[model samples]
Target: MGSIFGTDGIRGIYGDDKVNEDMAFRLGKAFVQFLKRSSDHPEVIVGRDTRISGERLQKEMARGIIVGGGRAFISPIITTPGLSYLVHANRADGGVMITASHNPPQYNGFKFFNSGGEKLSRSEETVLENLLSDTDPDRGLKIREEAVYLKEATESYVRFLLSTIPKDMDFRGIFIILDCANGATSSVASELFSRLNIVHGLINCAGDGENINRGCGALYPDSLKEYVLHLKAVAGFSFDGDGDRVVAVDERGDVIDGDQILIIASRLLKERGILKNNLVVSTIMSNMGLMDALRDMGLRHIECDVGDRNVYETMKAHGAVLGGEESGHIIFREHHVTGDGLLTSLQILFAMKYFNLPLSKMSKWMVPFPRVMLNVGVKKRPEINSVAAIRKVIEDAKKDLLNKGRVLVRYSGTEPVCRVMVEGKDRKRIDAWANKIADVIRLNLN
Candidate 1:
């Protein structure tokens, strides 16, 4: 009965109170009704990752779509971005991707994208939520239309990704390591790398439905880092469960986060006169050092809230070509609408080829300041500014750091926790300050 959509979409533990077959069916019917506003019999593309629950959830959703007089096209086991690309390419009315993204396999969710390959807006999501609440479960006439399987959906997406780079481009000498997170990209990343003619080694690609994001992928890339170092490859790329986010490692086994990736790509784009307005967009979670690096390069930076949707909106507003979060959701407006991990890996390769430098050396352009982040479990999320004690502590920390660093305290949109982050030149000072703020928040909220 609560709101279904979160910052990303409707996500929760599979079989939990939040997400189940009944909820998915309702969502499918609501989505079809929403689309009926523009079209008589809308066609929707439904896809899912490698989760064990994905098959049942998607089947239930397709059933609701059919009962609501809409056609459902299923692409079994596809990435989130792949679904987006298919929606745009196939000119479908809309699309639904069943995934939990970087979450564990036990959790599953749904992401809806419009025909233009963009995520549903806040208002659109609200309309669907309202429909779900009001619609009767057994009121609609259950039509018996079998969902059509889109056998070529994955192949089409692969072709699109290959066309992004130059046809003559060859990665023969580039030995790279890829960690597919044993999720959606498990079936696609290896093929793409192979077709590109790269000497690549893959890890964590053997998914058993329950193994997705199990101490692998972007959330846990220590093993990939070590492997990259051991093999002395050019670089290593790690993708999340749904292949919309990525984290990279340099040849030296040093991790390159989204901030560094943004800096590297933006610099290259600027030199080629492809960076629109010479500007970039990032979230508040990004390191302060990125701003300093941008200033040095004579580029402008804009900060938004902590979400890829927010970053994309700001990018569109300012005509920025590149934007991303520290969590590795990098969006290149010149390419796809949503984030694509495989495409991001290609861009990194393009940068390396153009610059003719190793990722470790190119990443040196930005020196990240020491950052400390702490999460405090909370019973409820009250406004941080309304708490006198929390506000005073934040103000004091900001004053102490002054121009040397920054402090940010915000509540998580998905979890019941308050995140406190402090960044400065001194590691010890920032760590202490971060814990101090966290303690104050816990005392007040928890």
Candidate 2:
């Protein structure tokens, strides 16, 4: 039940024994030591978001890295995308990002990257856990002292961003607003819009470590929805705490999820004749309309478990060009291996420019069906994956939802609960189906 790594990486509420400096130091030492044993003088990069404990963890981690005979470069409070950029641009041996993503302020985690700037492979993680649990610092590792060269990553990151996108993006006629989520995308999005000559406004642009995602991020799109209407902006976008996911506010202030974003991006890619194998990877959480969009264009879909990494792995397995979560961690296989919210925003903007269409019009390609989702809390979750009782409920729900709707029930990966979802053309049916499944799971799985 206890592992250092969680859904993302090493995560726990701050000031807790599980995610303290000692564990941070051990994790750092384990990585550097493992790298040294595998090669000589492995250089790496470490970056963090604007969390209060970020600085202390950075120092302790870096010391462990240097002590284990590796060079560690420090990047001050940049978005998660920025760290990925540094890993590729600087060609570091590895990278570590300190973030808990959309988790509360009191929680923090460390995400490890391999030499390729992607998440650590399962094998690598297993090795690191072994080393962390058993290794002693004083006698087993070599030591050194190195300076942390603080990097202004956004400047270079933005330029790299600009080059990947088209030259003449004229959103002048479109008034767009952006919600920075009081996290990492605060500065970059504003500057990107101005340089593109795209007329836009912004909110929650400054992040106090304590203020991040405090009622103002992708998870809280209502804030941006209100802003979109207040400013009468053409559209608005929201970035998560680490700026890896984007949620948008339409002209009508309707919140747009990644399914719609995927539909738009996939259509654009298909138009450009760059979509690989005419395929996309999405989770079961994707809207039903997305399937219709794919069907209309004769494109296929590969469904994976609900996670960006799972989607990425599916993309790699099927040789698909694109994949992402409902949240906004869209990945374009051609550009980068992992999710980049900045990249996703640019892709959407580029699509709008190419089509010379409004965000609302672009969204028309896929008509989203109503979806109902709820989390059922219980004392403890039992094995419901293949239980006959849960299977019967699923079978009955599937039969009832045939041809017009669907049902999905799974334990929450990040929380102590189970998720029930029902999607269909009818809201009442969706709600009833969702609640019925929830009731069954609560009675048995719970």
Clashing pairs in 1: none
Query: Considering every candidate listed, which one attains the maximal TM-score?
Result: 1
What is candidate 2's TM-score against the reference? 0.93
| Candidate 2 structure quality by residue, lDDT tens digits, 237-285 | 8888888888777889888789889989999899999999999999988
Candidate models: Cα lDDT each: 0.90, 0.81
Q: Report how far residue 276 has shifted in candidate 2, in Å.
A: 1.8
RMSD of each: 1.4, 2.3
Model 2 stretches astray by more than 4 angstroms: 137-143, 386-389, 443-446
- For all predicted structures, in order, the TM-scores are 0.97, 0.93
Extract clashing residue pairs from model 2.
175-234
Give a tens-digit lDDT track for model 1, residues 1-446.
44778889988899987679888888889899999999899999999999999999999889888887899999968899999999999999999999999988899999998888889988899988888777657635656779999999889999999988878876778999999999999888888888988889999998888999999999999999999999999899999999999999999999999999999988988988999999999999999889999999999999999878888889999999899988899998888887888998999998899889999998999999999988899997778999999999999999999999999999877667899999999889899999999999889896
